[model samples]
Target chain A: MFHLLDIIGTIAFAMSGALTAMNKKLDLFGVFIIAFVTAVGGGTLRDVMIGRTPVGWMLDLEYVYVICFAFVLTLVFRKKFEKLRTSLFLFDTIGLGVFTLIGLEKGISVGLHPTICIALGTMTACFGGVIRDILCAEIPVIFRKEIYATICILGGIVFFLLKSFHLDNDILYLITSLVIISVRLMAVKFKWYLPTLEKN
Target chain B: MFHLLDIIGTIAFAMSGALTAMNKKLDLFGVFIIAFVTAVGGGTLRDVMIGRTPVGWMLDLEYVYVICFAFVLTLVFRKKFEKLRTSLFLFDTIGLGVFTLIGLEKGISVGLHPTICIALGTMTACFGGVIRDILCAEIPVIFRKEIYATICILGGIVFFLLKSFHLDNDILYLITSLVIISVRLMAVKFKWYLPTLEKN
Candidate 1:
């Protein structure tokens, strides 16, 4: 189930990146590069931080194939996909939840402090988009008023809180993912945002 | 001697990042974050790629202290430093040279191919500025027509070519660094640029 969710998330992230590249009028190589980075950059960062070499995407060629498929899909159906904003949002939210859980688990495996684990989870869920925005020469939406990373952090907190109750691992994962997805959807639906500081 | 140069390079990179942050009107915390990332982000990336755990900055707290000192220096003497553009450019160039050598050596230590080592060296010398530019919501100067990264690559090639002559390690280092700094200075003086793609 986790593996399936991960694949779905990867495709979604890749499509989002490809669409952004298209909007920026990037070359074909640039589009593929951006798509691949957006799909795997967060996990790659997490792995690198904790001393994992060759990174996840480097180990598995499937990620490359998936990103390529996503890029082609975006290129061929740009207009059709334009009307799928809600679906894209849904996939992105699911991706965020799954990524957070993966990061949190990796941190636990490494025996990092819980607070640090929460940070890792947030980074895993958000840094892909951060890298994507950076590559596109834009301030990351999460770094601004977006409620994205905040929701990941909250979900991480919930993960640990439930861990204290000794629930089954699969149950814990399900609950945490649900919390993240629900929070993200509600935030977008209600137009919730963190307040930005006024320019001085 | 390499240690001293490394410290100097760190300080220069930190100052460069701090200046960029100030230009963007970032808060004090943002200033420090940007400064720290610019000082160590390149090397940290290289280390991560080569499977070095915990990264250099994490192992040595001195980098943090230095970045903080640089940030304070920038914060206090903003106006005075405005007239020091020449000094800043010199420091930046020297930093680039030293960082390239350090990355090249690290890559060699890991037994990577010479070409990959050269790429790593270039990344080390330039990625800090790339990160800083991205954080500031601008395209990295190196990604455009700037002759920055090209100089590092050239220096790396020189390092290997000179190594074939069995030069002493220190001599090799000196020659490589000189090549990088000279190329950068000459490029800037000559207004050298790679041709950018025309807007489609």
Candidate 2:
């Protein structure tokens, strides 16, 4: 069940990345590479930081296949999906929530502190997008006055707190995911933003 | 002192990165950011992987100043520097050697195993350039059939063996840097390259 959600999240993330490349009018190889990076970059970073051997993608070749498939599918549908911005953002938002939950769950299971787990969750959900934006030569929207990573951290904390109360594992994951997705979507809809460069 | 050498290395690295960005005709802000990232990205990655808090740049504001200074200098001498690829490559090579030695020294100071120390050294000295090239939308030459990273690792091992023999710190740094720089320069002069993968 968990694996199913993970694959769904991976496909969604890859599609979002590929859509961004399409929007930018990059070549086919460029689109594939960006999509692959967006889908795997965050987990690779998290694993590397934690000293996890082989990295997540190296351990599972299926991830490469998934990213390739996503890239091809996006290319095939490029004309039909001309209005890709809204749909891509929606997919990316879904991925953000689910990936945050999974990252927090993995970190806690590995015996990390709660603060670190929250950080891990935020990184897992956001770093890939950060890298994507950086490579596309743009300032990272996620870090500068965006409510994106903050939503992930809040959702991660909720998971730990609920789990500590002996909640069902499935219930914990669902509620965590729901909270994040709802908060992020609502923020986008309302054009919400965090204060940037807070005054002392 | 090490701080002085670090500043020199930063200037060289930033100038190299800025030159590449200028070749690509990027804006002033883009050039500055690329130069800054090329200067500090590798060392920052090494420190983060080793779980070091307060990354080197955050510890000393001078690194930031160094990059800013480098940007202004590059802006002044853009045309002159552009016509001096040979000299720029020499400065870049020396910076690589210095960075490799510093990375190995930091790794040993932090008690990493010798093999991992070598890995960290190569990462610190070369990863920044790889990232810089990627951001410029070029395939990283270091990864494309080159002796770059491999040379850094070899010199790092030499550094470790000498340190283990209770060699003087200054002498060890000198010898290691010489070994790395000499081999890299020779490789370039002789047109040395690794064999490419056979096409299907």
Candidate 3:
């Protein structure tokens, strides 16, 4: 079940990356690179920081295939995909939730502190988009007061708090992911944002 | 001698990152984050690619101290440092040279392909600045047809060509680093650049 969610998230992120690359007029190589990075860059960073080498995508060629499929899909139906922005946003949010859980689980398995785990979760969920924006030569939405990383952080806190109740692992995962996706959707619906710093 | 060069390069990169962060009007935390990323980001990426985990800085605190020292130096004497742009550029070039060597050596030690090693060297020397630029919401100089990563790739090729003659290790290091530094300086002085893609 979690694996399915992971695949969905990866595809969503990859499509988003591919679309961004096309908008930037990047060549084929740049498009694929951006898509791959946007899908896995965050997890790669987390793995590297925690001493998990050869990373996930390196170990599993499935991600490569998925991202390539996403790239081609986006390229073929750019207009149709653009029109489905709402659906894409939903998938991206789901991806964010699952990614946060994966990161938090990895951190716990490694015996890191709770605070550090929350940070790792946030990094895992958001850094991929951060990397995509950076590669596209734009400020990351998370850093721009979009309330993205904040949602991941809050979801992480919820994960640990629920864990204290000794709930079933599946139940815990479901609840945490739901919270993240709901919060993200609400943030968008309400046009909620953190305050930006004033220009000096 | 190589250690000294590494320190010089780290400081140079840190200063460059800190300065960019300041220009972006990032707060102190953001400044430090950018400075640290700029100093170690390339090496960290290289290390992660080759399955070296916990990375170099995570293993040793010396880099942290050096980067911190660099940040404080840049912060306190911003004007003086700005006036020393030429000197700073020289240090940065030297840093690039040594960083390239370090990356190349690491790749070779891990028995990676020669082409991959050269690519790793270029990435190790340049990606920190790339990360800094991306974080600062600017296009990376390396990606912009600047004669930067090109020099590192050429230097890597030179290093291996010289190795065919079996020179002394210290001499090889010095010659390779000098070649890289000279090429970069000349590229800047001569306004040399790779041809950029024509906008569609």
Candidate No. with top DockQ: 1
For model 1, what is the alpha-carbon lDDT of residue B61?
A: 68
Q: What digit string (tens of lDDT, one per residue) describes model 3 on residues B131-179?
A: 8887988778789867899999999999999988999999999899999
Name the runs in model 3 displaced over 4 angstroms.
A1-44, A48-122, A125-129, A132-137, A141-200, B197-200
lDDT of each: 0.85, 0.79, 0.87
**Highest-scoring model, lDDT:** 3
For model 2, how does the per-residue alpha-carbon lDDT over B1-200 read when each residue is reduced to its tens digit?
Answer: 66666678789999988988988999999899889989998998778766675678899898899999999999999878648778778878888888998788777777766766776788788878868887898655564546677778789878878888998888999889899989999998898765432111
**For candidate 1 chain A, which ten residues in a row score worst on lDDT?**
A191-200
* Native contacts recovered, each model: 0.30, 0.03, 0.27
Ranking by TM-score: 1, 3, 2
- The residue pairs found clashing in candidate 2 are none
Pairing residues by index, what is the TM-score of model 3?
0.62
lDDT per residue, candidate 3, A1-200, as tens digits?
A: 89999999999999989888988999999999999999999998899787886788899999999999988988888889758999899989989999999999988987776766876898898899888988887866566556788888899999999999999999999999999999999999999876432223
Candidate 1 displacement at residue A189 in angstroms: 1.8
Ranking by lDDT: 3, 1, 2
DockQ of 2: 0.06
Candidate 1 error regions (>4 Å)? B1-43, B56-130, B139-200
- Name the lDDT of candidate 2: 0.79
DockQ of each: 0.18, 0.06, 0.17
